[model samples]
Target: MSCCGPTRRTLLGAMAVATLSSALGAGASRAQRNSLIATDLELVTVTDRSVIMTWTTVAPDASGQPVPVASSGAVRVAPVGSAPVTMYESAEPTPFHYAEITGLEPGRRYIFEAESEGVRAVSALNPVTLAPDAPEVCGEFTTLVPPPGRLLRTFALGNDVHYGETVSGLIVGDFPPGFRSLPDLPPYPEVMLAALLDDLRAPDRGAQRLILAGDLTAEATPSQSRSVRAQLDSWGALGRDYLVARGNHDRPHTGADYASCAPATADHRDCFTEFFVPREELVQHEIGGLRLLGLDTSELDGTGGRIDRPQFDHLTGILTADPDRPTLIFGHHPVTRTSGATALAGPGFILNASDSTELQTLYTRAPGVFLHHAGHTHRNLRTRPDTPCDVEFLEVASVKEYPGGYTLLRIHEGGYMVSFYKTRTPAARQWSALTRNEYFGLIPAYTLGHLTDRNHVVHRDFSGLT
Candidate 1:
């Protein structure tokens, strides 16, 4: 239970659809052609006075097949009893659109209609409503109340960069086809990462620091690790401005391409460790009096994660020494199962059950550890463990594929807010839209979590953090 205000999960879960899966599979098809249709429209980010909406435009192709097509985008927003306002007139046509509606009054409800090439977008009838039901209105959402107290810090959290991979959505065993970038275009990973950096540079999204939770590379090859490192260095001074955690794909590999590197656990070569964690130890850093703990949860040979004895002991000592210090933990694998992850891959997709249980027990002793950020499973989910502690386990979506983006953590004196942002660069948006069909079109249902999961406010007293 939350020690602050009302339980956020309970309140939000009450408005959730009974079964999102059934709605996605059984809902009536509202297909159309001969005109532009905006699909997958979502309120990606909702702040106190603004919301970022994203969608893909569909139009008839050369073969008369309805497909994602480039088109100008705009939105009509109007508060009740007020005239509609048009915003976000794109100068260039793009198949993928990100529309930011700003200048909204806090706590005011507004009706919105997203349009492209004169065709208005309609929300898919789903069991769960992203906002309060406005039956006759096209779409409606209430802006949030700003967190109380002075704003102190902002950080960008992203992961699953997957630097060297040419293909995405490839799983072992017989699965649906994977996707690759257009032959003449740059790799999808590079396109998305560049766009992420560009977006982070915006004044409104000014991120003082960055934390890439895991999966820094497609494979832990020396070349791949070096290339990824160079790219990150282009953004900021590595150890001071950004930190990285290891994911399953970053674990040492035994492939012949890495035969020259030093051996790691078992027969694999340790290129990722050599480049990222030269000291081969867990890292802890302090910024503005806030402690950041980076954990390497990758195992030697499997997708499941486990902390080494030494690293676990070090974490225990650190937490025991400063039980009340404001802290945020970042790692590759989630410590608990998220609904989206379970619906997609089952228990193996997260940290091993035993390790997760032990960590939860540890969290019980640390009152100031409020959030644990993780990647892997390529989804957006926020879950609270059944343990007595009040910490939240947040899983961010991938930066290298569909729904490509990161989450912004805004720390205020009295509380904090988290909002997920999809990469907005034109190329990045295109790649994201193309990969939405991953896993046989089941990705959206399992990866694009409920609105509450992606954007929400958590009240906590952190005035002492500096």
Candidate 2:
């Protein structure tokens, strides 16, 4: 699971996941039964002193009856050898709980177990640094380690989580038999993402921030959008440790036909922005000395994308604020050449020609901008703008389907390195392979690329950035 794997697009084919998480009162029979099936367990947020987790409680038998809560519910955590476990219980009886723990020691590891009434389950966040002799049944996670030196911070980048998009074909909005929906697969986003969270919780990958470049959901419906946003929260809250950019699919789509049905947006606007990038159409922030600029370069009801004048200007101001600060700007549309199914790419797969040229020019002028990452092509490709600048335009593969994984960006004092790490959990790997042939079997050729796409080196003179 640690090794990099070939790329491919996963068509959910067919999977049925309950659309709702929390239900109302429980049936009398369920009152005493521990029918709470907790899945999608995740550490939603973790800081030097606190951590938050969220998960779903599969509802009771579908007899149109309400599900009962456990007689008692609490998250139990303890050090490996510690006998007494610390339990944090929620007063609410909902299936969805954001279990929170605070005042934890940074870099300390703990074994966590969650239980409510009749069910007790262990955490899946196994530690990456446990001793071989350590017990294997317990769920373990360590608080994030603080960056040591001139290293301003570390962040993780992932994209294309099409929640509710069981059939990969619908995501591309197609009707070919190959793009037809299959009803025999497991939940696409849930299983793959569960495995991803499992991997992120490990000791070595405690990224301080997470940015989803775009395509946050299959269709922007309320439930799907809500669920996708919640899934992202399984890592951290929006505006804090996690943020999102809009994708062409994330625009305010509306149609009568299911295939054409687009996920609903906020104020009839784009929910992708509402849920994650609520503060601004484009986001700009600084971590230590490292700057991150997130832009929404997508269009409504369109398969392609664009960097609107407003967003372009917003980014311009951000880049101008600290031209010398090491910065990484990202969005949904690619800005360079792509491979595979080239005929199907159309204009939107990459930025429009005019904008592309202008962006390269802007990047060249801002030498501090070392990386401009994107998604949407669902393939991994790295381009060095071909201008008088070092800005590398990289397009990351989709995270929801085959080759399910993400890029880890480690920012050091002088420069930074990006390495693609595939999700290691059995479920993630299984599902990724299961959906590998999406888009008429051309996804593999387009989404996965040469080994160079998975690893990159950026040597910049950062002697001044301590």
Candidate 3:
């Protein structure tokens, strides 16, 4: 999840003032409390030395929909027996709160409490109780140990950009109202994509390479593909500095919108193949002793995926040739069987069960293959299959909606670490906050994974890679 920047907090504060004033004016004619209430408190991220928290403050409205109330937000945090240090946001009052507690000790347990305008917050684990002397325990976490080894390279891995799409959470055949970008704001996809690139550009982010796993566009329209390509071009050179895998949304389509695009291997025209993969072949890149493989997991006219015989054979050949090259594979659909029950798109959300099994078996042969990156589920999840192969199936959240950001893969000589970073641009953070209400306000529970899922380290002998 995102921590709102100063500009975002300032804007939110202004909006809160207007909303609170209007609510008070109308409250004279109705019955309501003038106090603030904090809800949806989440412990978003915790690392060796820091933790991030977020929540919302709302004013009761007669319409039953709560109005955002601008109140100063603060979090009190401490070790089990240490004096607490209070971290506060900017002087501005914002309904949305993001507080980061730093200088924490690794492997130590910490407790935290959040409040706005003197009103304590309620979290999923905390309920409303009338007792006045309640222990202010909103949540607690044990910080993790730092990853071993000297940091080598940091690469940004993200997916589900969904350019050219206007709405979010509209599953096929479940056509209720989905979330839309604020009418007065620019398209959320554009705002978010730009912000993601900007964040990666920052020197502190230290991203040497970028990989977008899939869903670069909404419909694989020629224009949509070109637009996403242009944005990526502004960041770095493709093939050399960045790479992309085709997503289900970027599959071939039979329509006039794609009539002028190059003919696809399938019956329909495919703009994605025309631009990114004219040969329509699998991708491989050797970077500083690391082998990166990009798989085209998209099926023609279907959301599920199956590795065709040709692609599967190609992968087998590559892995068999250098079975100890320290490889990483990326695609759009995750191994369905490993994705667990949180896959919002149902059983077909990923590669078919048969394909998933075959792929896992293949991994057992390639000892150097350490990770598989995927992104169709739009949620942060890290799962390892039941097989004996020591590989991680890491699925990242979407870049265009709630929890908007990418994951950073920090390679080291002794091991590697993967941590999610929410885009910090003001516009990006605002859009991220606005879209948090998607999926009937259950989006956070589905997307904001536990701290370990968002940030963790693995011990491996990566000393071979330069």
- Please report the candidate that would top lDDT against the real structure: 1
Candidate 2 per-residue C-alpha lDDT over 1-466 given as tens digits, one digit per residue, 9 for 90 to 100: 0121111100111111122112321123343243454433434344445555544344344553334243445787765566536568877565444466776786777777665554543222212111232222235555655444465456788888877776553343355322222235457677666666666667767777878888877777667777877877877778777767777777775444333332345324444544555423787776666678887877665666677787788788777776777888888887754322242556556777787778778887777898888988776677666467778777787788755778877776656666666675545544543344355434445555544465544567555654
Ranking by TM-score: 1, 3, 2
- In order, candidate lDDTs are 0.77, 0.60, 0.75
lDDT of 1 by residue, 108-210 (tens): 8777778787766543332233233422123767777778999899989999999999888888743567777755578888888899999887998999889
Candidate 3 Cα errors over 4 Å, as ranges: 1-33, 61-64, 124-138, 340-342
Q: Kindly list the per-residue Cα lDDT of model 3 for residues 311-366, writing each as its tens digit.
A: 99999999988898899899999884658455877778788888888888989999
**Predicted structure 3: clash tally:** 0
- TM-score computed on alpha carbons, candidate 3: 0.86
Candidate 2's C-alpha runs over 4 A off are: 1-152, 169-186, 255-269, 278-280, 337-344, 439-442, 463-466
What are the root-mean-square deviations of the candidates from the true structure over C-alphas? 7.3, 12.2, 6.4
| Candidate with more favorable, higher lDDT: 2 or 3 | 3
Ranking by lDDT: 1, 3, 2
